[model samples]
Target: MYFGKKNSEEPEIIMEDTIVYACGSADCNGWMRKDFASENYDCPMCGSQLVEEVRELPKIENEYNAFK
Candidate 1:
């Protein structure tokens, strides 16, 4: 790695508590935000049942998930 000047203008993010759906299977790591979830849907990665949970996530200013 080459040495370079470190920029100090990186934006700071605010953490917020949000509800999300997580896979019920212990071996699966699939999860999604609440608003992006569909009713009665299972984990998209492992097809396991989903459970509701709360997580601290990076706050969004104006961007939103376009798939919803």
Candidate 2:
């Protein structure tokens, strides 16, 4: 028995945080966390409005500017 070897049967851990804002536009794929969104609270893409909703997704870092 080798103590240095770890078991490979352990299950992987997955964390699904509930915090995300999706663009209201049907053709936009922009989304970000509530804490990272702009103060205006608008969609990062398409310059559309955003609605707060609970969704399971990974965290991301992005900056949205409507003046583009």
TM-score of each candidate? Answer: 0.73, 0.56
lDDT of 1 by residue, 1-68 (tens): 98898898998888999989999999999999887787867999989999999999997643466633
Per-residue accuracy of model 2 over 17-36 as CA lDDT, tens digit each: 76778888889978877766
Tell me each candidate's RMSD, in Å, in order.
3.3, 8.4
For candidate 1, the TM-score is 0.73
Off by over 4 Å in 2: 1-13, 58-68
Worst 10 residues of 1 by lDDT: 59-68
Scored against the true structure, residue 58 in model 1 reaches a CA lDDT of: 93
Per-prediction count of colliding residue pairs? 0, 0
Each candidate: what lDDT?
A: 0.87, 0.72
TM-score of 2: 0.56
